[model samples]
Target: MEITYTEAVILYCLKQLKGERTIFSLYHLYQGKKSSQTIQDAHLYHLTPFFQAFPFISREELARQIERMEKKSLLDKKSNEHFILTSTGDLKLGEYFQANTLPPKYLDGWRHHHLTALFWERLSILVQVCSNLVYQKKSFIPIQNKLETLDWVKAFIKKRQEGRMGLSSTLFLELLNCFQRDKTIDPSILVLRLTGQDRIGLTSGQAAELLGMDHTRYQLEFLNILHFLIGTVSDEAVEFPLLNALIPEAEKPVPFTLSTEKTFQLLNRGYTVEQISRIRNLKRSTIEDHIVEIALHIKNFDLAAYVPKDKEKRILEAAKETSAKKLKLIREYAEDASYFEIRLVLARNGDQKWK
Candidate 1:
């Protein structure tokens, strides 16, 4: 089935998460919410790369797409908060994968960089120089205006040549193959233009007009394509030193908030939430929120430590019946189960199967 980019992205995210995800989490991921360290660490925000391509999409519009997808039987509403891809949706996504070379939202980690413009500028300049050199043209003017950048690119090219013969050719061929296989022509043309391929090469402004895209959208697409190429080539660096040198380092560790780290430390020491709250001079509710955040981030966190087996059984049953949407309704069904316990159960097991 033919699906819009938004629908395709939604399906891809659901499948990647094993066919189930909360609406809230999905929205936060696509909207690129920075509040949650766990989401950032996982590189879950896929929409940031295409902000210009999808300028019209908003959180509200995304929610509408989810509803539309559910109505189309592309997704099954498992609960008020979560949805799972249906068999039809799975088959459709499989078709998309078979037809498309580049995975949807492939350069999601680019959003994490603070100096994205510099990264792209340096990369494009390097590619242009390398492509020209491979074609045996040494007299071309530098695409980058800065003297420092020109010097750096010159030294970088020299180092690769000294390390291995045909390194530049190998890197350029790999990039060409990746772009040629892509479902979209824009990315391939963008890369070709940037690298100064003989017939198709054009300046950025000229390429944007040829592709019928605005300058911003064209630039965003080009950057995403470059990022994807860097990632793909970097993985095979053991065989391609030139590619390895071109790609940047992986993301740094995501830091937890001081309060959340303190709460985690206390919990690790076997302190009860109440005890932690008393010792830390915070409310019990605040302590519980910290525990939830910890459980969400730490895969092996023991939710059972706070919720007894019998009480967990009651909460799971109530959650299954009512979809875990409203905690108050769950509390009514699960008599004597504290709100915190209910929240914990929902947080840990809402999208997964209950024991």
Candidate 2:
């Protein structure tokens, strides 16, 4: 059986989850929900690489995919909202990936999504401008709409010592060198989306149709390429100066949601959770949610600050004993530990420390 790219992604996620999670947990993961449970689950399951990889996929659409997969005998319905992968499904997944490599390994969407998006926007406008300039054509509309990007392009180009022609050449050569270095990646999928002097770049759907690939597949491919470029450029910035310029700041471990970012700011200012809750006029539980979110992303966060060493040890032990990610399940075994403490432990260490 030929498993499609979309099927392959879902299958990979299901396998990682191992039916311990509800089907909708997959939905929330893709939707990139900011809830404490979803955020902790994304990290705990080791599925952070694909977090928010399909934010636009509707729940109904996901159900349809599951139904079709069930019909194909790739999924076994263990319950109304949970599924287990069949042995045949596992074999098929292995075969499918052997034939097609994808769902890029180092996505870090939970970490670099915002940075990736901004980098793409900057690259898009730069490409558009360079294309028009190559044809000696002016008066073309900018591909990027954000005022920040527009101003960035103006400021970026002005600051460059190279003239327009030299800048374009360097940009083109750097991109070529980077893409050419990776034989597994087909750069055409990405390049086809770039607007050139002769034509506007194709939309994602258009590019997918042209490539005879699924829309989801095309998107994953596109994102993988961006991540690939971001990684390539970051480490070799001196080699790809123009590419590195787009990512102006040192990347944060994970991009925080605005609310969580506010929480982080307070933590940085040496404010206690109770103090922040009162200052922000939010519930204590809500502030706790922010703290858990902080634990999930901030590597240096001291777990002992809120949780005593013994409680932390108990929670970790329970997670190992049961191999369960569910808070209720862990709470049952870790009777003395609260749900919040369990979450903090999971967020801090994820699956790595225990399992």
Tens-place lDDT per residue, model 1, 139-202, is: 7766668887787777776766433237556766665666665566456445546645253357
Candidate 1 segments exceeding 4 Å error: 1-28, 36-125, 128-167, 176-287, 324-326, 350-355
Tens-digit lDDT string for candidate 2 (1-355): 7888889989999988878888789999888787877888888888877777888989999999999999999999988889989998999999988877645755666766767789889998999988888889988888789998999998998998888899899999999999987898888888999987877999999999999989988887888888889888888889888899988763445567799899889988999989999999999899889899888777889988889999998888899998878789898888988888888988898949455
RMSD of 1: 7.9
Residue 82, model 2, lDDT: 93
The total number of steric clashes, by the backbone 3 Å criterion, in model 2 comes to 0
Best-fitting candidate, measured by TM-score?
A: 2
Clashing pairs in 2: none
